[model samples]
Target: MQTNDAFSFLMAWAAAPFRIGSVTPSSATLSALMTKEVGPDTGPVLELGPGTGPFTRALIEKGVRENDLTLIEADSDFAAMLTKRFPAARIFEMDATGLRHMALYNGPVLGAAISGLPFRLISPRRTRLILEGVFANLRPGASLYQFTLGLRCPIDQTLLDQLDLRATRIGHTLLNFPPATVYRISRIPVTKSYDWRYA
Candidate 1:
């Protein structure tokens, strides 16, 4: 991470520790792990809370086009910085929960999403709303990659079941400050029911 980015993150965290979640920008190692599964072929990507654009840079390195990225950052300063840093990308200065009410694309065309939001700090109700919004914009078989400092998945199991979603631990990196684990959250495929008589 650059010195300026770290300073900016520190300031943001100081202002709102729960919202910023971390004292510094995400490490390169964690960013790589979060974006490894996505690339140009993944089509449009959505990123939540991309503070300082660490994962955004990683997504670019993985071959995702700048214009294909849509970033949702509630922090005004970070959103402004992202606009200047990635002029081709779309940056929204709004809370991610608003995604449920907004249409980011023509339809569910986004192939993937990367989230840096602090699920651990957010209430379960809001977490469910956020997940619902994200999945509503994702294409079939697409996933939302999230990293958390918690030992287990930050999303509650009850909420996951209610949403018909599942989370799998993709990987973890000790290099990041406080260390973090990445989870791939995807919707469970619905199976068609057959009539016993028809069978």
Candidate 2:
């Protein structure tokens, strides 16, 4: 990680601890685990809140092309830094929760979404919207990868049910500052049920 990266992350955290989530950028071990499921063949990938590009670097190392990645960062400063660092990537300086209002991005059905967002700090309603937008753009079976400092999944069961999604714990890394676990989220197909009242 670059010295500037840490400094920038610290500044962002100092401004809004809850929004920034972590005081420091994610560790390399955690970054690797979060991007383990994606690659060039996996199609285009979306990265939410890629503050200093730790996971972004890992994804590229995993064989994903820089041009095939879309980075959505709410913070203008981090977004500007990411744009400079990754010239080929599509960087959008917009809120992840506002994805619903954005045009459908041009790409193959997104292979996966690697998030650095602080889902634990976001409200359930907004979290649902962010996820709904993610699912709307992803291909069937595409996974959403997220790392959390908490022992439990950052996303609650109620939201998962509403989205018809399931979370699988990928692995836990004690190497990180506060330790973190990665979860792979996949949408579960919902079967339509017949209503007897109509008959």
Candidate 3:
């Protein structure tokens, strides 16, 4: 990571530790783990809270075209920086929870989403809104990759059940500051109901 990036991250963290989540940018190891399952084939990608664009860089390296990226960042400075760094990407300087109301695309066209949001600090209700908004724009079988510093999944089980979603631990990296674990959050597959009378 660049020194300026680290300084900017530290400043952001100092302003609102809970909102920023970490005092430094994610390490390359963690970035790789978070994006390991996504590639060019993933189609248009969505990224939430892309501070300093570490994971965003990894996505491009994984062959996801710059134009295929839609970044949602609340911080003004970070949003401005991202625009300059990724001119081809669609950078939206707005709260991610508002995604459900916004028409980011014509429909559920996003194939995957990677999140750097601080879920552990957010309230369950707000978390639900964020998840609902994100999943609203994701195609079936698509997933949202989220990383947390907590030992367990940051999203509670009740909320997952409420949304008919599931979380699976994909990987973790100690190389990252304070360490972090990546979870793949996807909608549970729906099975057709059986009809004994027909049989």
Off by over 4 Å in 1: none
C-alpha lDDT of residue 141 in model 1? 98
Provide TM-scores for the models: 0.98, 0.93, 0.99
Residue ranges of candidate 3 with Cα displaced over 4 Å: none
Q: What is the C-alpha local distance difference test score of each model? A: 0.95, 0.90, 0.96
lDDT of 3 by residue, 55-127 (tens): 9999999999999999999999999999999999999999888997987899999999999999999999989
Per residue, candidate 2 scores C-alpha lDDT tens digits across 10-88 of 9999998989999999999999889887877997899999999999999999999999899999998999999999999
Candidate 2: lDDT of 164? 88
Q: Over the full model, what C-alpha lDDT does candidate 2 score relative to the true structure?
A: 0.90
Candidate numbers, best lDDT first, in rank order: 3, 1, 2
- How far residue 100's Cα lies from its native spot in candidate 3, in Å, is 1.1
TM-score ranking from best to worst?
3, 1, 2
